[model samples]
Target: MTAPRSGSILTTYRRHKELLLLLLPSMVLLVLFNYVPMVGLVLAFKDYMASLGMVRSPWVGLENFQRLFASEDFPRALRNTATISLLRLTFGFVAPIVLALMLNEVRVSWFKRGVQTLTYLPYFLSWVILGGMFLMLLGSEGPVNWLVQAAGHSPVSFLSNGAWFIVTIILTGIWQSAGYGAVIYLAALAGIDPNLYEAAAIDGAGRWKQTRHVTLPCLAPTIVVLLILSLSNILNAGFDQIYNMFNPMVYDVGDIIDTYVLRRMVYQDFGLATAAGLFKSVIGLLLVVSANGAARRLSGGEHGIW
Candidate 1:
């Protein structure tokens, strides 16, 4: 039985040799860049030393994890990461879906395209550029503050205030990615069967009723899959955006695990940094698996990443 199974596998591969060849580079790259580096995860369990190297470094068992939990910054970073990610999941996640729905209702082609183009343009811009642009635009003496002062208000320290900084992060994050997300939802919307909408309309349903009954039901699987993916990244609080936008004033509210790990790396605390990373990976894996299981159970084994 094993010999027959092995032969069948080879036969299938031979039949799809061209397609597999096309996929070879990506598979190789994934192994090299992703799987290969996983070997370094062992550093999390060791007291890494420059002189002794990764293999020869003394084993520390759970000491690195213990120190990570004991650190003042780690707790703060963990809280901030969860807070920001949840905010993004709630508001930022919904924004794109809303935008896609609105766009789908637009009758004018040029106007809809223009809106999409303008909205998604920011996603292409690097955070370094956007961060600098935002810093200038939101500064005390900038145009935004100018308008605030003109309206009989004091200049708001958007970047310097912790609460305001969090608001800024959420708003800017939404602005940057909403268009791209909307495009994804729009593609999913296109795949929905037109007959479902027509059937609902034939039942004397209004546009809202049709959307609620037909459109939303059809979009459920896509929504479920995207929601599961979002939940899996509950620990990721947009490191690039936060790193570029954050300062000491907002550190209490904005600092996250990625940035915390970066600081550890800068200080050459390899074991602790690796431990933090391993912890995040473990949490993410558990979240994704749990989310997938819940989705399958709720959807009667029809929906989810699997």
Candidate 2:
């Protein structure tokens, strides 16, 4: 039996040699970029000295983590991460789903394609560029402020003001990502059987009824899967966007875990920064597991990471 299985495996490998060869580069890249860097995670528990190198670094156990949690900036960063993540999850998550549904209903192919192109164009632009564009647009003497002054009101600093800054981040995130994110839902929608809609129509269902009973039910599994996956990003509040858009003035409401770690690294606290990163990773893993479990239970084993 073992000899037969080995021969079978060899046969399969030989048959798919070309495909395996094609995948070799990606496999190598995955190991080099993703798996290899995991070794540096140990720096979180060590008093890392660049001169001593990773292997010779003194092991300090949880001291780095303790210092990270005890830092004055920790609470503010945590609060900002949680608030912004939640806001994005609430609004940003739904925007794509709605856009996908709307696009799916469009009868004109050219118009729908044009709409998709325009909406998703922002997603392809780097936040570094978009950040500067947004800043200029929202600047005190920029077009928006100029229009505000024309209307006889004070020029509000959208990027500098804490509350407005948070709202801006969420709205801009939705605008940037909604169209691209909707692509997944659109794929899911395409996989849905047209016969289901026909059946519903034959049963006296109108457009709204068909949508409620057919379209949504078919999309539920995909929605749940994406929602469970999103839980893992609870601590990640888009470093590029926040880092570029925010100044010290809005740190109270805009500083997130990534930005905090970047700040620590800038100050040469490598150990503390590593500890904070590890902390975020650990929390994110726990959240993914918990959310997966909840999704499995709520969905009667129909949805989960597993």
Error of 2 at 28 (Å): 6.4
lDDT of 1 by residue, 1-306 (tens): 344454577898998899999999999999999997799899999999999999999999999999999999998999999999999999998999999999998999999999999999999999999999999999999999999999999999999999999998999999999999999889988998888888888899999997788778878787877888788889999999999999988889998999999999999999999999999999989998998888888778877778
Q: Give lDDT per model, in order.
A: 0.92, 0.91
- Which lDDT tens digits does candidate 2 get at residues 1-306? 344454577898998899999999999999999987788899999998989998899999999978887888977899899999989999999999999999999999999999999999999999999999999988998998999999999998899999999988999889899999999999999999999999999999998898899999999888877887796778988999999899999999998999999999998889999989888988988988888888888788977769
RMSD of each: 3.4, 3.7
How close to the true structure is residue 64 of candidate 1, measured as C-alpha lDDT?
A: 98
TM-score of 1: 0.88
Top candidate, metric lDDT: 1
TM-score of each: 0.88, 0.85
Error of 2 at 250 (Å): 0.7
Give the lowest summed-lDDT range of ten residues in model 2: 1-10
Scored by TM-score, the top model is 1
What candidate 1 gets wrong by more than 4 Å, as runs, is 1-31, 296-303
